[model samples]
Target: MDPFDSSDDSDDDIFFRMMYHYYTTDLLQPDPTSLLTRCAMLNRNREEGHKHLYRDYFADNCVYGAKDFKRRFRLSRDVFLRIANALESRYKFFQLRYDARDRREFTTLQKCAAAIRLMAMGESPDTMDDYMRMSERTARESLYTLSRGVVEAFGDVYLRKPSSHALQELYVVHEERHGFPGMIGSIYCTH
Candidate 1:
């Protein structure tokens, strides 16, 4: 009947032993936040590389120009700028800053372009470094932050369910084109 006695093989004794082990062993481990934060510091030394890749190449009309920029980035420069502006205004992490060493960090333009390219092309983050002049880790972080920022900033307007009027218009267009009144869309089922 004693609670501290380990001789008993009851379920309660087993539960207590497991709980005690978890608390004393796993819960007492040192915090890993510092290590993770240190590793997360962005490599601002790549500023020159980023400028060369983005400004000198992508934005230069004599090189990639507006058409090539649109094709490669999957967005027009104006649209890209608008999205980057929204992200920068809404998310502090997307804003460029100076590191402790007074080195300039990646610009909002670079982060947005990298993230948009990854999403649009579905390429591995490793492949982005050569063209984007960003580390793979930085590219991944940019994608993560940009995606979440976009969802938070523009999800209400872009990702919401269609309104009834919109749905009705879509139904009318589909019916006229396909000759089916009730058919909303086509589905391909595979076994």
Candidate 2:
């Protein structure tokens, strides 16, 4: 076991041997057919879900009014519509489409609603399946797509860095509101 002896296997050789053994013998490789097996598709009736959502929130004489919409979504219905519309116009993913079987997919509002629900309520993707008639994967995709869409669509105005005057105003406002002079934000510790 001498360090400089060229007789024994080197550390790299030992590591590669271990890796090769693990891959060849220890690892349980999955079957290609098993990889092709998918979950059973459920007829969640996405069209019906769309109609219900429209009747409850967007349609005239709908079940829920503007106040209810605002309370639930943390944004006024008009503002939500504006964002949804902007995203739909900007991102093709937000547009309604038909599947290969000619089955209508979820509407733009449904996808946006799933994304907003995830943001507003801090819910997981599975929670949207029952309400939005979308699969968990779809709900997760909607969240990501909506986030990217919003940043691309409205990042210039909403996510821009503040000007010097704006920062000064924010500092003054923070001081007046919290009685902490010149405190704009927490550095590390978050409440």
| Winner by TM-score | 2
Q: Locate the minimum summed-lDDT window of 10 residues in model 1.
A: 182-191
| Candidate 1, residue 94: lDDT | 82
Candidate 2: the clashing residue pairs are none
Q: Please, what are the lDDT tens digits per residue for candidate 1 over residues 45-147? A: 5677666667644554446677777887788878888889999998887888887878777888888888898998898888777766787888999999998
TM-score of each: 0.63, 0.71
Q: What is the lDDT of residue 18 in candidate 2?
A: 67
TM-score, predicted candidate 1 vs. hidden true structure: 0.63
Residue-by-residue lDDT tens digits, candidate 2, 5-47: 4457888877777666667764578877988898677999999
Model 2, CA-based lDDT? 0.86
What are the lDDT figures for the candidates, one per model? 0.78, 0.86
For model 2, the superposed segments whose C-alpha errors exceed 4 Å read 1-39, 167-183, 186-191
RMSD per prediction, one decimal? 9.4, 8.7
